[model samples]
Target: MKKILRRLRRFIRRLLGIKPRMVWLTHPVFLQHEPGGSHPDSPERIRAVEAELKAQNIWRHLQTAEAGEVSDTQLALVHSRRYLHFLEANQPPEGKIYRIDDDTVMSHDSMTAARFAAGAVVAAVDMVMAKKAHNAFCAARPPGHHAKSGSAGGFCLINSTAVGAMYAIAEYRLQRIAVIDFDVHHGDGTTEIFKDDPRILFLNVFEADLFPFPDLEKERGSSPNMLHTPFERGASSLTFRRRIRNEWLPVLGSFKPELILFSAGFDAHRDDETGRLNLHEADFSWLTHKIVQTASSCNGRIVSVLEGGYTLTPLGKSAAAHIRVLAGKGRGVDVMRYNRRLKQRT
Candidate 1:
């Protein structure tokens, strides 16, 4: 009887160890039907990462989910109704791109894709709140950080992160939410939308003098709720990690955020063509670990969304490492599931 009880105890602990914290994956169709002629923001970005996740064997632990279309009412929480109307009504000609300014473009499926991407984030919020998983990641495209309240830019139509933050606060009554954007480019859109609100803390780290270069040091939001760390070209991962440890982490702890959202952009990777930062696959994994540790202290609520990582090899490898850490899968495990819900969605 003693031996049997010991074995049962061990079994319970092992089962608890393997249980997922929580993970959500967006559908592949979210990438399909874009308007550009093979732009960097193509479907291949998510596909490569998905393949690597499967190759890593980390995919099995994540719960699969579909990104439903966000309602206009929810979208209006962050964007203007007029702008939303314009985006829905104006569809670009097939096989041609309609520029939403100089940096953003629209294809036939852009609207639907954007809606689903936003919806995926909302689903993540729901899952986290329901305690289905410890945290979740939204692997959708047409990145949202650079999108503004009234205009679409930087290949982004809707600010998915912003919309998710709003949903958490308004719908779920989560106070003291925080958004940490690690994209190589500043999240100007998220900043613009939440500048006046004190309920959220928007922290960003991006390359200095990159696209949408106007958000420099003097660009203060309506509240002291914003912080920016602009690194020069060739900034090393060590330096980046130090900033997080010394600067960002302290502030985040003090804030005691109820929920943490990551604008996870791999464009800062060394091999990425978008920026000069020299981050590696290890950097993404370490950063994810740090974020998870931080979230664990606050009831383990985290949501990571795909932002910008263009190079196929680095993007796939880096994203795989990040997701591996998120899923609590042991390192070096190849063959992960691409979309935990892919089989169901099909």
Candidate 2:
């Protein structure tokens, strides 16, 4: 009812003409966490995204803010005490890299960067909650979807989506919050974190056969509130659309989330070899539109966090497409400029 009133007011404002708000949260502190030496999850990913948005001229429309580091209390929202200590204990000396797991690594500044990345998401939630912005995109690195409570995997550390969602529950006193993950890999960490909580609905659509293979049956996440739509390797745009239209939308409608969060991963793009899915820029644009429409029903609030998108060219292009839709730019992606930017990088 309140959302209806807000929309009515917006509709009235359009008669006088006022624009909706969109914000982007990022920081140089996010740049300080590089693992070095051919790491796919390098800080350069953020640079690529930043440069692309500027090259495409979409940066002009976004309100930009630097993310503050997360408090210890905020870290506890989703991480264990031991895990917190582990990140601190495992930090490598300056100019060195510490391998946390098979694919996860940390440097002297890793903990700080991870905190800020997670903090950026929490801050995005705050922005939407306080109406500082209608929607936000967090282009921070070292993606969090694969981080478990006490373990880091798939280049993730603190499970930022979980942190942000729990922060919404505890800080904003919100129930029925929904987290949607469209990364090429399943958001196993996020699913595990909210497994027992029916109030926090988790929806994931990832490539069916991918890395960090957990028991598929076990990953049903102990509740019907959790929905997983896994697609095979050769899955294309048609199947992705079908799943979103048929599988995700129905559940999302019934859930009626007060706020929505996206684990926006561009690695699912066909141009990205990190994961083998045939999604294109149009697919990313389409997903964002659907999510935005869903958010409209819930007061037009969304917080999007960067998860996975290894290949730079596709990552930049896809992210720009996603942000365009988020910024209400109507699928406006500068593919020619993105291509030029990629060529310059090579």
Q: Candidate 2 — worst ten consecutive residues by lDDT sum? A: 333-342
Against the reference, the lDDT scores of all candidates come to 0.80, 0.84
Candidate 1 structure quality by residue, lDDT tens digits, 1-346: 7547745654675578754455756876677747465578878888898788787776766666667788888899989999998998887766766777766888878888898899989989987887766788898978899889998988899999999999999888888888989889988898889895778888888888788785474775435888788888898766887888887777777788898888988899889988899777777777777766765555778888999998988899988888787777644422224222223545
Question: After TM-score superposition, what is the CA distance of residue 311 in candidate 1 from its true location, in Å?
Answer: 0.6
In the range 262-311, model 2's lDDT, one tens digit per residue, is 99999899999788998887788888888767655668788999999989
TM-score per candidate, in order? 0.87, 0.89
